[model samples]
Target: MKVGLIGFGKTGRAVASVLLESKKVNLQWVLRKSTTLEHRSVPEFLGVHSDEPGLIYSISEFSADELFEKHPVDVIIDFSSADGVDYYAEAATKRGITVISAISAYPDNKLKLLSEIAEKIPVLHSPNITLGINFLMIAAKILKNIAPYTDIEIIEEHFKSKPEVSGTAKKIAQALDLPDESIKTIRAGGIIGVHEIIFGFPYQVVRLRHESISREAFGNGIIFALENLVGKDNGLYTMEDLLLPYFHLNETEQMFIEKNTKPWWRFW
Candidate 1:
């Protein structure tokens, strides 16, 4: 399928490399305005469809209206910053193009805007997209019941170059009802990403961890989302809902867990 990449930064480059290797994706457009140096130095990459050369263009110079008129992209994966993400989302929705955003926004207000726009078109919004972490969500739900009444703490570590703490950790904390202040963030060299949540009672601590040794771990979830979009239409979806089938919890088991589980809101 034809796809568009909105950012050409490190994560975007990684995503492009994977998509190109899979050979299942046709990257139709790369929207970015590089400095004069980058424009001259950016090399031909794998993600750029071999048949479609020079798809990368500066957004600073290219208007959204011009993009819709000149090119048609089925899905747009936006790894751009919050500054232009909202505008791009609105423009993409108006054009009926499905959009996926890896960009994170603040104070909850931007998220509200994103959700509202997503409802108008097929939008996959996620702070983190690694399938391992999605599985962690399932495990967290399971632990919520079996380990209810236990003290919970989460630790997340990412590469030293990462500008912020792990978004995955924050999401887990939110899901598990752990106070925001209790989640610990660590930065270290060469670590792609790692998140461990521990449940502690009087005598034991149950730890559930998801670790990414490389950036390729993100491919599983990205492909899953893409496949889902191929079959479905417009709506906002998260990795949690995408990975639900793999959970395989029986009704009786679910009920039993529910009986002992603490609601996430109570964690604070």
Candidate 2:
């Protein structure tokens, strides 16, 4: 797969580092708002030994149309600001390129625009794209389904600079129909991110937690998304959509159950 990246900030740089090291995908180019590193090779800038032409471009120098024509890629992984979608939506749609937006938040209007573009190609939008976080969400939902009356609480922690509640935590809360008050926030040190969900039953407490030790986790999530998004029908998708198919028991497990377990009526 050939990949294009948007945004070269702290997290973006980390993701680029991971992509440059991967063998499965070729990183064609990266677009950033600043011109400080314009026209530079990403691999050289990051000190990685690769020959993939991982160049960097300033958004101001090249229009989206020109960039897409010059370096067409299989997919565009966006870790840019919420408005970054406006820059590539039309061009990407025209080329039928897959899009994976890891933007933290998007207003209603932009979300509607994403939906509109999804009509032409596969589009995935995720606030928190880390694989562990998405897996945590799926597990939390399953636990909720199993114990509907269990008392649940969501706790999110981030760096001290981030004051607002985490969008991911909110999504987890919404998934379990939890009220805002049920969420607890903690801001400290340089923590990348942490989300923990606690399920309180009559006899025991269950906790599911996902912690990001590094921003490279986002790149791993992008790789996972790319692997699954291929040949998908044109539509809007989330990480949950890509992961749900894997939650079922395998054939061997199912066969074992069938062979070993008797029907409830037989015991009665």
Candidate 3:
């Protein structure tokens, strides 16, 4: 797959590093709001060795239409601000490019715009795009479904600089139908990110925790999205949608079940 990236912040740089090292996709270019690294090679900037022409461009210098027309890509992974969608969404949709938005949050209006654009091409918006986090959410939902009365608590920890509650924490709370106040936040030294869901049962306590050690985790999530989102129908999607299919039993599990089961007559 040919991929383009939007945003060049710290997280974006980390994601680019992961993408540049991957063999599954070719990173065509990266678009950022600033011109500080304009026309620089992403690989050279990241000090990696690659020949994919991973260039960087400033939005001020190149319009989205011009960029897409001059350099086409199969998918566009966005790590930019929520408003960054306004810049490339239209052009990308016109070209039928899949959009994978890892933006942490989006206003209602922008979300509506994304829905409209989804009618033309696949659009995936994930507030927390880390694979482990999304898996944690799915597992939490499943546990909630199985044990509806279990007392659940969500705890999110991040770097000391982030004061507000995590958007991902809020998402998990919403998924489990817990009150916002049920979320606990811990701000400490340089903790990349941690979200833990505690399920309080009568006999035991179940904890599902996902910790992001580095921003490159987002790139891994993007790669997972790319592998699944191809050939998907035009629609708005989330990380959950991409992950739910893997929830089924694998071949080994299926074989184990088959081997362990006996006919009802054999029970006699």
Candidate 4:
């Protein structure tokens, strides 16, 4: 499969690395202008064709029309900022290309509009795409059933470079019918991502946790989503859709919860 990566940053480079290393994927070329000598060397080592200067998109200034008219990529992976991702994603979907976005912290209007469009095309918009987190989402549902009397509180920690609280916390809060204010985010050094759900009562506290020691674990989930994008029906998909077997949700319940319980959407 020919894949185009937008926003060639750390995550984008990682996605390229994972895809190139995999047998089923082909790194067609990147879309952007300003390539350094170091960036130019990336494609050679990855064993894929690099499109630069001659029909290559290098600059970050991609207008929605330009993105729609010029690019013919099958799948576009967006790891760019939330600034203009909605436009890029909308344009990609209108053109029948599946767009998978991994960025977080965006306005609700964008997400609402994205969901509206997704009913027509396949679009993957996930704040945390790590499969482990998805597993947790499913587990949260189970805990809701098994631990009926427990009160849940979420806490998340991330690296110092991270700008905001954990999206996983926010996602978990939404899944369990908790409010946005009920979730907490922490920023610190040397920590990749950590989320803990504390289920408490009068006498005891049960903690369920998941931590990310490296970015590669997150990339594994991205690759998982990309792998499934092929021939998938049009719809808005979350990490819950990408992860399976770990959770005990049936098809009917999964669809109902995904459609209605998206608390992150409440931000809009």
- Measured by TM-score, the strongest candidate is 3
Better of 1 and 4 by TM-score: 1
Q: What is the per-residue lDDT of model 1 for residues 132-166, given as tens digits with 9 covering 90 to 100? A: 88788778878788868988888988878888766
TM-score of each: 0.82, 0.94, 0.94, 0.76
- Write down the lDDT of every candidate, Cα atoms only: 0.73, 0.93, 0.93, 0.72
Q: Between prediction 2 and prediction 3, which has the larger TM-score?
A: 3
So what's the TM-score on candidate 2?
0.94
Which parts of model 1 are misplaced by more than 4 Å? Answer: 35-43, 46-54, 161-163, 201-203, 249-268
> Candidate 2 lDDT, tens digit per residue, 1-268?
9999999998999999989899989999999999899999999998988889989999998889999999989999999898999999999999999999999889999999999999999999999888999999999988999899998999999999998999999989888888888999999999899999999999999999999999999989988998999999999999999999998889999999999999999997
Every model's Cα RMSD, please?
A: 7.1, 3.0, 2.9, 9.3
RMSD of 2: 3.0
Candidate 4 clashes between residue pairs 3 or more apart in a chain or in different chains: 32-57, 32-58, 32-59, 33-58, 33-59
Model 4 CA deviation exceeding 4 Å by range: 32-41, 44-56, 60-71, 161-163, 201-205, 244-268
* Better candidate number, 3 or 4, judged by TM-score: 3
